[model samples]
Target chain A: DVKVTQSSRYLVKRTGEKVFLECVQDMDHENMFWYRQDPGLGLRLIYFSYDVKMKEKGDIPEGYSVSREKKERFSLILESASTNQTSMYLCASSLRQGNQPQHFGDGTRLSIL
Target chain B: SQQGEEDPQALSIQEGENATMNCSYKTSINNLQWYRQNSGRGLVHLILIRSNEREKHSGRLRVTLDTSKKSSSLLITASRAADTASYFCAPYALYNFNKFYFGSGTKLNVKP
Candidate 1:
């Protein structure tokens, strides 16, 4: 079975603080993604990495960025956390090619106050 | 800006009943996938149907896709209380290699 592990399950941060969320996959997948889920908005892609040191912006990538220094690890960074940035963040990974199914981590619920 | 949308945002049914959820996408897709999320946790991939395949089944779940209409439907037979969750449809486009458009999801409640 594929395992995707997130570093934080629940996180609380203050406004204007820098936050980092980490994810690691054991499947040796080449694709990694970050998404923020909100009610009525579903899951919106924030950023994705196709390979080590390669990143791409999704539909809503203005407030967030990503890092993929290694194949097994992916990180999401918030430049300066805001109250509006509070959301449930999810990390996913899949094979490099084809329309493969993505495996997801448990998710981290971030609260900004 | 989601590419797919689910119909009947919420549904309620009794145990042993059959539940169906429909999803519609805006553009052409390489494949359509269904996912299940319990409460507010991460999503679990339930099924995946390519554009060329019309229908597929696994266990008690059945999925049907219609490329001409750009729609798909998921049916769970003999639903159990444990089947209660939010179902989302994601249409993977050919243009993007590592991205998918996920639907808002359909929340289902099963009463014993």
Candidate 2:
């Protein structure tokens, strides 16, 4: 079975602080994604990496960035955390094949105060 | 607004009954996928139906796709209380890889 591991389950940060969320997949997938889910908004993509050092912005990429320095790890960075950034962050990885299903980590609920 | 929109924002049913949820997308798609998420948990892939495939089944779950109408439906037969979760559909667009648009989801409550 594919396993996607997120570094945290619950996180609390202060305003204007820098925050990092880490994700690692064991299946050697080539695609990784970061999304923030909110009530009534569904899952909006923040950023995605197709390959190492390759990144693409999704619909809501503002106030956030991503890093894919290695194949198994993808990190999401918040330049300056704000209360509006508080949401359940999800990390997912999938094979390079378009037809393959994505494996997701349990998610990290970030709280900004 | 490329996301798939699920109909009937919420649903409630008893155990041993069948539940159906529908999803509609705005544009052409290469495939449509369904996912289930327990409260506070990430989504679990339920089923995937390609544009060319009309129907597919996995265990107690059945999915159908209609390209002409740009819609799809998921049916859970003989649902149990454990089937309670938020069901979402991702309509993977043609030529768009790695980017998935998901709906707000249908909250299913199967009371035992």
Candidate 3:
């Protein structure tokens, strides 16, 4: 079966600390994305990578960055954790084109204190 | 920026009843997709309708897209308690299919 794996199901970090969220997909998809889901705002894009080492800014890329060192793996980095950044982070993978469906990992619920 | 906006932010219905959700977008799109997410879980893709396609169906889920109106709707027939989840509409712009925007979503509550 196809699967997208997130390294952590839950994470906690202190303010001003750096945090890393990891995601991997075994489906060999070309497009990977990072999004944060909040209570009223829904899911807001942070960043996405189409190919290894190629990344693009999403709608809300202010407090986040991503790295794609391998096709199967994508990493989201939080330079400095803040309380407002606490939310559920979702990672997804899809075919090279958007016409195809995207596969998602369970998600990493990060809490910044 | 989010392009799609789902109407009836929340809906409540009894089991075996049909549920319909609407979505409106502000720009041209290459395709529109629907997704469902249970509480505390990742989103699951429900359906996708290309710009050229008007309607598509899968199982009990039906999706309709109207490019002229920049909107779409998802219909769930005989909804079960399991169908109670948040539904989101995503609209992809132009050639970048992966760059779609998602709305806040419509939370459906199917009471048994």
- Candidate 2 residue-wise lDDT, B13-101, digit = tens: 99999999999988888889999999999999999999999999999999999999999999999999999999999999746776888
Which ten residues in a row are the worst by lDDT in model 2 chain B? Answer: B93-102
Candidate 3, CAPRI quality class derived from DockQ: medium
Best by lDDT: 2
Give candidate 3 regions above 4 Å deviation.
B95-97
lDDT of 3 by residue, A34-67 (tens): 9999999888889989999999998889878888
Model 1: CA > 4 A from native: none
Residue B78 CA displacement from its true place in model 2, Å = 0.5
lDDT of 1 by residue, B1-112 (tens): 3278998899999999999999998888889899999986899999999999999999999999999999999999999999999999998886877698786899999999
Candidate 2 stretches with Cα past 4 Å from truth are: none
**iRMSD, model 3, in Å:** 1.4
Model 1 per-residue lDDT at A54: 97
> Per-prediction TM-score, please?
0.98, 0.98, 0.96
Report the candidate with higher TM-score, 2 versus 3. Answer: 2
lDDT for A6 (candidate 3): 98
Where does the lowest 10-residue lDDT sum fall in candidate 3 chain A?
A95-104
Across B1-112, the per-residue lDDT of candidate 3 in tens digits comes to: 4368998899999999999999998778888889999988899999889999999999999999999999899999999999999999988876554676777899999999
